[model samples]
Target: MSAPAAALDWAQGVWDWAAANWYYPDEPGRGIRPRLIEHIRLSYASIAIGLLLAVPLGLACVRWKPLYPPLLTGVNVLYAVPSIALFFLLLPYTGFSDWTAIVPLAVYTLVILLPNVVDGLHQVPDHVRQAAVAMGFGPLRRLVRVETPVALPVIIAGLRVASVATISMVSVASLVGLGGLGRLILSDGFRRQFDAPIVVGVVLVVLLAFATDALLVLAQRLLTPWARRDRPRTGSVRRRRAAATAAADAPALASTAVAPPGKG
Candidate 1:
C-alpha cells in the first residue's frame, strides 16, 4: 500500500476501535461517564484547594509588597520542579493514593495562581482605591468590594491557566496509579499499543481545557461589565476615524479656498 493509504487505513481502524469502546452504559461505573467524572473531580478539587491556599498568600503578598519578590521566587522554583519528580517526592510520604496526585496538582495550581492574585489586586486603579477610602471603607471592605471585583479579570485569567495545567498534569498521575482519564492513556493505550484510548484521552483533555477556559472568560465578562461597556465597537472606531479625517481636512480645505487659487 502507498504511505497515504496505509495511514488512512490505520486511522479508520482507530476510529472504529474508539466507536466500539468509547462507552459502557451497561457496565456499572466502568466507562466514559465514570472516567470523565473522575477527571473533572480531580481537576476541580486541585484547583479549589490551590485557591484556598494561594488566594490568602497572594493577598498577604499584596499587603506586604516586599514579601512578593521572595514569595514569587519560591513558587517559581516549585513550579520549575518537574511534575513527575514532585510526584515521586511526595509518593513516599503520601503513598500511591489520590493525595499524592492531588498535592502536586494543587501546588502547581497555586504556583500559577498566586502571582495572578497579587498582580490583579495591585492592578486596581489608585483612584478607585482612593474613592473607596474616601467613602469610609475599611481596608478589608475595600479589598473585598473594590479591589477584588476590579481584579477579578486578571485573577480568573490565572485560574483559567491553572485549571488547564491541572487537567494536563493529572494525566501524568496515571503512572503512579492515581490517574483519572489518564489511566486510559497510560495504562490501557501504551500497554496495549492502542491508538483509540490514547486519542480519546487526549481529545477529552483538550475539550475540557477549552470548556474550562471559556467558562472562566464568561465569568470574567459577567463580573466586569464596566470593561465591556468601555470597549469601542469596530463600527464606532471606523466612524470616529472618518470624523477625525473630515475635521482635519476642514481647516485645510477652508485655507485653500480663501488662499486665492493663485497657484492655479
Candidate 2:
C-alpha cells in the first residue's frame, strides 16, 4: 500500500480505539470520560480557590501599597519553583491525594492572579473613587459598586489566562497519579505504544481549555456589559484623532492659505 493509504489505516484504527474506549462505566472511573471529568474538576477548583484567595489579598495590597511589591516577590518565588517539586514538597502533608495537586495549582493560580487583581483595582480612576466618596459610599460599597465594576474587565481577562494555564498544567498532575487526560498520554499510551490515546488526550485537553475560556468570556460579557461598549473601535478612534489633528491645524492652514508665499 502507498504511504497515504497506510496513514489512513492508522488513523482509522485510532478512531476505532477512541470509539471503543471513550467511556467505561464497568470500570467505575478509569475511562476517558472519567479522566476528562477529573481534569475539569482539578482545573476549575484550583482557579476558584485562587480567585477567592487572590481577591482579598489584592484588596489588602491595594489598601497598603507597600505590601504589593513584597507580596509579588514572594508569589514569584512560588511561581519559579517547579510544579513537580511543589507536588513532592506537599506530598507529605497532602500525600497521594487531589489536594496535593490542588494546593500547588491554586498557589500557581494565585501567582498569576495577584498582579492582575492589583492592576485591575488600580485601573479604577481616582476621580471615580472621589465621586464615590462624595456620595458617601463606604469603602466596601465603593469597591463592590464602583471599583469592582471597573476592574471586572481586567480581572476577567486574568481569569481567562489563568484558566487556560491551569488546564494545561493539570496534565502535569498525571505525574503524581491525577493526570486526568494526561493519564492516557503518559500511562497507557506511552506504555502500550498506542497512538490514539495520546492524540485524543491532547485534542481533548485543548478542547477543554477552549471551552473554559469561552465560558469565562461569556461570564465577563454578562458581568461587565459596559466594558464592550466603552471600548473604542480602532477605526472610530483613528477617525477622531484625524479630525482633532485637522481641527488643531486648521488655523495654521488658514493663515498659510491667506499669506503670500515666501521667496526661497
Candidate 3:
C-alpha cells in the first residue's frame, strides 16, 4: 500500500477502535476513557509529590550550600535507575496499585526539579539579593517575595519538562498490572498484535504531554509577568528581565554591598 493509503487506513482504524473501546456503557471501567483518566491521575500525582519533595530539598540546598551536592547526587541516582526495575522493586510493597507507578515517576521528577529550583534561586543576581536584604527583607520573606518570582520561569521550565516526562513514564505502569493508556499499547495492542490500540495509546500520550507542557507555559507567564516581553518570544524574556533587574538595581545594590560594617 502507498504511504497515503496506509495513513488513511490507520486513521480510519483508530476512529473505529475509539468508537468501540474508548467508552462502553456496558463495561464502565474497562475502556480507553478510564485508562486515559488513570494515566492523567498518575501523571498529576507524580508531579505533585515531586514538587512537594523537590522544592523543599532544593530550597534547603540553596539555603545551605553544603546540602546541594549530596541531595542532587541522590536524586540523580534515582533518575539513573531503570523505571521498570523501580516498578518491580516497588511491586512487592506497593502491589499493583497506583502508588507503584506514582512513586517511581515522582522520584524521576526530582532529577529535573531539584536542580532547576536550586539554580533558579541561585540565578538571582547577588546585587538584587543585596538590595532585598538591605531593604529589611528577611531570608524567608525575600525568597517568597523577590527570589521566587525571579526564579519562577526557570522553575516552570523544569516543571514543563518534568510533567511531560511523568506523563510518558505513566505508560510504563501498565507493566505492573495498573491501568493507563499503556494497556492499550501493551495488553490490547502488542499482545494481540493490533495496530489500532497501540496507535491510539501513542497518540494520546503525546497529546497529553503537549497539553500538560502548554499549561505549564501559561502558568509561567502568569506567575512571572515581569519576565514577559512587550511581545512574546521564546528563551529571551527571562534572561533579559533577570539582567535588566540586576542592572537596574546595580547602583542601589552597590552601596548596600560596600557599606562599612556596623554602620547604620
lDDT of each: 0.77, 0.81, 0.80
Q: Rank the candidates by lDDT, best first.
A: 2, 3, 1
Off by over 4 Å in 1: 1-9, 25-29, 229-264
Instruction: Evaluate residue 59 in candidate 2 and report its C-alpha lDDT on the 0 to 100 scale.
Output: 86
Give candidates' CA RMSD values in order. 14.2, 13.5, 10.8
TM-score of 1: 0.80
TM-score for every candidate vs. truth?
A: 0.80, 0.84, 0.85
Predict model 1's lDDT versus the native. 0.77
Q: Write the per-residue lDDT of candidate 2 for residues 87-158, one digit (tens) a residue.
A: 888888987888988898898889878988899999899998999999999988888788877987777777
Kindly list the per-residue Cα lDDT of model 1 for residues 111-213, writing each as its tens digit: 8789789989989999989999999999888888888888886777678777877887788888787778888898779999877788888888889878876
lDDT of 3 at 195: 87
| Cα-lDDT of candidate 2 | 0.81
Candidate 3 overall Cα lDDT vs. reference? 0.80
| Residue-pair clashes, model 1 | 0
Cα RMSD for candidate 3?
10.8
- State, as a TM-score between 0 and 1, how close model 2 is to the true structure: 0.84
State, as a TM-score between 0 and 1, how close model 3 is to the true structure: 0.85
Write model 3 residue lDDT over 166-260, tens digit each, in one string: 88878887888874898899999999989899999999999998888667655765677776544456458777767645543343234324422
